[model samples]
Target: MITQRQILGTGAAVLAATLTVAGCSDSGEQSGGDAGGSASIVVSTFPFGVEEFTQAVLDPFTEATGIEVEIDTGSNADRLSQLSLADGSNGVDVMLISDTYAGMGEEEGLFQPVTAADVPTMDEIAPFAVSEQYSGPAYSYQLNGTMYNTDELTAEEAASWDLYANADYAGRLALPDISVTAGQLMVSGVAASVGSGPYDVDAAFATLGEWAPNILQFYSSTTEMTNLLTQGEIVAGDALNGFATELVAAGEPIAWTAPAQGRYMATNRAMIPVGAENVEGATKFIDFLLGVEAQQASAEIVGDLPVNLGIEFPQEIIDVVGDIAQDPTGAGYETLDPREIVPNRDVWVERFAREVVGG
Candidate 1:
């Protein structure tokens, strides 16, 4: 379900999951070294095909810096294990992981600390997107909102987040379980609508309890939520921009919209291993990614929001995400600091189970 606990890079469950990340062989030799002595570095990103990411971010980076690049793809758990094993010389150079894992890795001295001086293009990122806990700023994000089956409800009825609580939606709604990122965003957005921020755990809980009756199911993933919508088993619920775009591409009659209170945002960041053999090259790659060209290209390929400032999205994207820029930290949207949610997440998840799900 990708909880903050998992994202924070902790828990016995995390240990168990990472222990399963066993495929990559440990290499003593430097990766991707060319005849000119320019050394290559290995990078791990979300579970993407080597060809897809190679075209999106890696190829442009290598072309610009003359540094060779090797790519690894896996879940957050696997990436954390790879980072732990790579420290001090085994050779994975950089990784794109959730903010929680990055912070935990920095604390354990597994990753190098980054600053604007190290990647001057950090100036192009929103202040909030720049990590206080890791070397790389946020490279991309998922802006979340209500996704509804267009044939089932008018756009006006789905214009506010309060629809999750309306009894009128009984047997027709779906939502993320409290343990996941989308669930946390739903809780925070509801809390904000009631004038309570995420810190007021009681307020968020109360809001969920009120909405519990109408929630057809508390989903564990976007796939489950979208599948229900596709089959007409559910009408609407919380979903991310990227995945919803996939639903539309697959021919489902679905649409995503930011409600009156605003949408919730979460970002995934990139980090360099603490003792990278090619620190200069790694930093250059990070800077190149933060630049508009890479950022825009990524948005086009992945459908996730870019973190680079001043990158205007296409009219089609702007239509789906009205009032909110593709960037979460951009003007007019409400953003949640994973830091604020991490400390209280376990308690909130427990409470949500007992109170709303009747666990």
Candidate 2:
């Protein structure tokens, strides 16, 4: 129920507290020497955009706090698996991963709890960013929606789930494969639309199975979906909103629209491993990442929707999502509970392949 105005208004005091703890100062001297003074941490993050991320977040943090940051990058699943296999000796101090993977790590005891006491900035982010189900907090989020060829469909048509099943668009539409993030969101959206709620698999599969014949491809990667859309091979697909940002900006005849019903979002979290070598450094890094300046830089460079409510988004971000970023929950977007998702993930993926895509 928090409005954008309220969130923005509350940020001034929060940012002041965050700056004190983060060791940032106008004199370019490390104010909080405990986390500075030659402390170091290894940060595991998504492989893409390393340069941009380092410039926007890591470099600034090191400059402000004198914490040495070593970069480690991989896919979410790969990094999580490594952490599990290492049994707390992964040497990873902090991990920036998706919420789903963070939940899995929490269940496996690979990560330790990160409370607001450890990261004061946690109190400033949107409520959803503070996880009740994981060991970390969400730093940024992605919304699931429809990305379509603007020349082929009206915005109204793209905003409805029915577009996937329309006979007129058969053989020219793509849907994310169940193995991917968008695929799971699409399933839940269908479930909510046709059955009792987001977890109603029976209703979701039944509806998706019927629509299968109309879909040209079950895409598993961003490249596949973007290529299909760019070449005019597919008219539309269910995808995360970020997928359409670049294409739309380049003057491609493409657009993204949030579905009229059953909207869902996914988050990227900042988690500390169970045996992190430098917990204090990790905590400081997380606090800095959640601060207003870092959040705004990330939104502009990484194309992520900032969880820091105080951030005034860049024009590029606004053009892609409009005011939805201001208050996702108010706009009807929901994030799936990882507790429910973790236990049933394998079964859901198997069934989706067999009953939905296999049909």
lDDT of 1 by residue, 1-359 (tens): 00111112334443344323322332225443332243566666665433455677778887877666665555666667656765634455667887756655665678777678988888988776875645668887777678998998877788687788788779789988877677777777777777556456577677777777888899987788988888899889887776777666666788887666745777788787866667776778788888988888776765657778767775556656755764444544655665676566677889989987883
Query: Model-by-model lDDT, in order?
Result: 0.69, 0.82
TM-score between candidate 1 and the true structure: 0.82
User: TM-scores for all candidates?
Assistant: 0.82, 0.89
Across 1-359, the per-residue lDDT of candidate 2 in tens digits comes to 00001011222443233211221122123212233343667787876776678888988898898776766566777778878888855667789999888888988988888999989999999999986788899999999999999899988999899998899999999999877888888888989998999999999999999999999999988789889999999999899999888888888999999999889999999998987767888899999999998999998888889999899988777777788999999999999998888999999999989998887
Clashing pairs in 1: 114-135
The candidate that achieves the highest TM-score relative to the unseen native structure: 2
After aligning candidate 1 to the native by TM-score, how far in Å is the CA of 26 from where it should be? 9.0
- Candidate 2: lDDT of 45? 80
